[model samples]
Target chain A: MKRFTAICLFLLSVVALATPAFALRISIVPDHGNPASPQMGDRLRFHTAIQNDGNAAQEGVLAWISLVETDSGKEQPVDLEDWSAHKAVVSAALLPGQTVESIWPMRLIKAGSYRVVVSAMSRSGETLTASPFVDFTVRQKPVVESSRIVPVALSAPLLIAGLLIWRLRENRARA
Target chain B: MNAVAVIARKEAGDLLRSPRGLSWLLAMAAALSAFSLLLISDAELSLLDNAEAVYGMCAVIMGLGALLAIVMGVDTVAGEKERGSLVPLLIAPVARDRILFGKLAGIAMVWAAMYLLALPYLWAAGGAGQNLAEGLVSLALLGTPVVLGFGFLAMGMGARLGSTRSALMVCLVILLLAASPVILGPSLRQTAVGRIFDWINPLSVALNALDAVIIDSQAVVSQWLHWNLTLLFSGITLWFARDGFYRTAL
Candidate 1:
């Protein structure tokens, strides 16, 4: 009975040590000094570092970024289609203790408080790891964007109409 | 060349002097202005990417140009026939094909003028965006062939049918069919038939090229295939117009 108990304890300890060897971890940092408050239309970039924490080689690992609007009355995930065209990165293989870094560039389109997170998962493994959310506020500029466009938009047609009228008068004179 | 030039000059002058033609040009400018103002002023629309706005402008420009071309085309032979001027024009020194070419050249001048008028609006929508220049170039490269192709095709129909109403009806149907794919949802667009039609459609090719050039920032060289297809479409339509006009009974 004593020998059996000893064997059982030894096997349990071995299983516990082997678990982390097959895992992956990811973390994200702002590429530039974190602008806690960025202006709308400002370009933002993040650096995501994905490392294999396992003793074995990691294969077919995928990393992607997610953005969520946190300050709206309702929390909703933002579509990154316009924000960043290249949101996902894939690694064919990552050896033990190897780190892969990817740069994600996005244009700020909306003014709101938001959080960005990077997540990674291995195709062969069931475990998924995500980095802590990085928070930021996007401020809207007060400038009236329409004032500049209205002049040109309204005048172009009037100018063309004037030309048309002149041409009509000329044709009538010729007649 | 001189005969073609003279006829072209006459055609252009006639179009410019006509109240109907001048109205269309004025309408185009007004439409573009309204569109630009809406894009910049609307709450949701104002937030869109500059590239998206530019793309919208390109589409509107192409649509307006195509409409003008079709109107002129259906009127090319049929209008003259109605006015009892076809016989005199046909008896001139130029061949029928050359006359058709001259008419197309006149239409091209108006389209060029339309393009020039749309530039300030394009600049306003693009707003110092890097895609503005590329979008302009793509519009010129792709839009010319596609817009003129509609003109030539409509003129061919008018030549063969000798009725403006019939030709206009046929052109509208073709335009609706060609433009239908663009209105369909993404899932529908992914279907086998849609994919095939998109690859062969001149309008689709031009839109795709603009999307690639402006949104994707792709090199113009990469769009050579689309350019070739649009050119080929125009070339075929021009031939059909020439042949139809050439074989017409005076």
Candidate 2:
């Protein structure tokens, strides 16, 4: 029984050591167009690279990008299905010491302070994640063009109607 | 008369006539078809990329099979008792054990038929060159215990509570328990606590079996262990169901 117990302990330790540890490093660089003054429906692009810093190669890496609204805590994911439509690009795998670039184009609908978060994972067998958040601002566009054209357009229709009505009244008085 | 055959025929007839049963079948078919189409499209893009992608595709198919088994099992017993026909059936000349076995056999038949119908579609979606015979075998083995485990739980609750709603809730909990490992395995990999959960989770075992068949093309021993545990659980639950039915006020 003592010998059996010793063997069990040895086997248990071996089983424990069999599982691997993964180390991953991720970072983001703002590319194409300024990070400042992003407009609604404008394509905002950023480059992200993920590297497997560990000694071993990892399999089944899933990566996606998300934009977080700083004030309201709302998040919008860069659409990967329409990657080119949204100007978003992604690579599913990266080798050890090898880096792959991912580009994301974001559309800022509502004017608010925002941060982008990029995340990566290796299947269920290992826990290697990189969540790097980048902060940026979207400045509101000036309404000067619409403001100038509105009063002139609005008054023109009213002025034409008043002139026609005044001519009718003057003709009636003359009659 | 052969008890299993008689019960199975009657039960299958009832299932065919039931709108809910037909709806379930239609729903599963639609969902599986949609998922299979998505995988096929993916496979077309990168045929020679990685063996893991093919395995992932098969996993999605097996996952759908497991979900269908849970839905069928949950309704097998509780649905019968709630319809007010269970009491008369219990009082019949047939042996109680045979009746219980018959119900399980009938539900198994329905699931098997569903699996068979879905297989060709899955094969077509997997593409012509993919080796899917081993994956199919693994899925069959893993699916048996899952179907029986959920069926037994539903029958046990049906015998005790005699309510379909309660049985559904119980089955949902069981489904969650069966599926939890796959969902939680990633986070649990780093800690001792997560390790314990992974070690005991049967879904991991089923997935591991799938990984072997589809990804590694290895033997089904690890998956067999999971099927065995599921069988053991089913046996225990069957005993509870038998005892509960015998003691009930019907």
RMSD of each: 11.6, 26.4
Error of 2 at B236 (Å): 3.1
Predicted structure 1: clash tally: 1
For model 1, what TM-score is found for chain B? 0.94
RMSD of 2: 26.4
Candidate 2 lDDT over B1-250, as tens digits, reads 6897789767665544444455555555556555444433442222322244445545554555556555555555666666777778878889877887787777677767666755655454433434467667777777566555556666677667767777677767866776666555557557896666555655566676677766676766645666776567667766776676666534
Looking at model 2, the pairs that clash are: none
* Candidate 2 regions with alpha-carbon error over 4 angstroms: A1-175, B16-18, B40-67, B127-130, B183-185, B221-223
* Alpha carbon lDDT at B61, candidate 1: 93
Candidate 2 structure quality by residue, lDDT tens digits, A22-122: 44677888875655566543457778887777555656666767665666655554334422344333445556687766776654544567777777776
Weakest 10 consecutive residues of candidate 1 chain B by summed lDDT? B180-189
Q: Write out the backbone clash pairs for model 1.
A: A21-A54
Q: Give i-RMS (Å) per prediction.
A: 4.4, 27.5
List DockQ, one per candidate, in order.
0.20, 0.01
Each model's number of backbone clashes? 1, 0
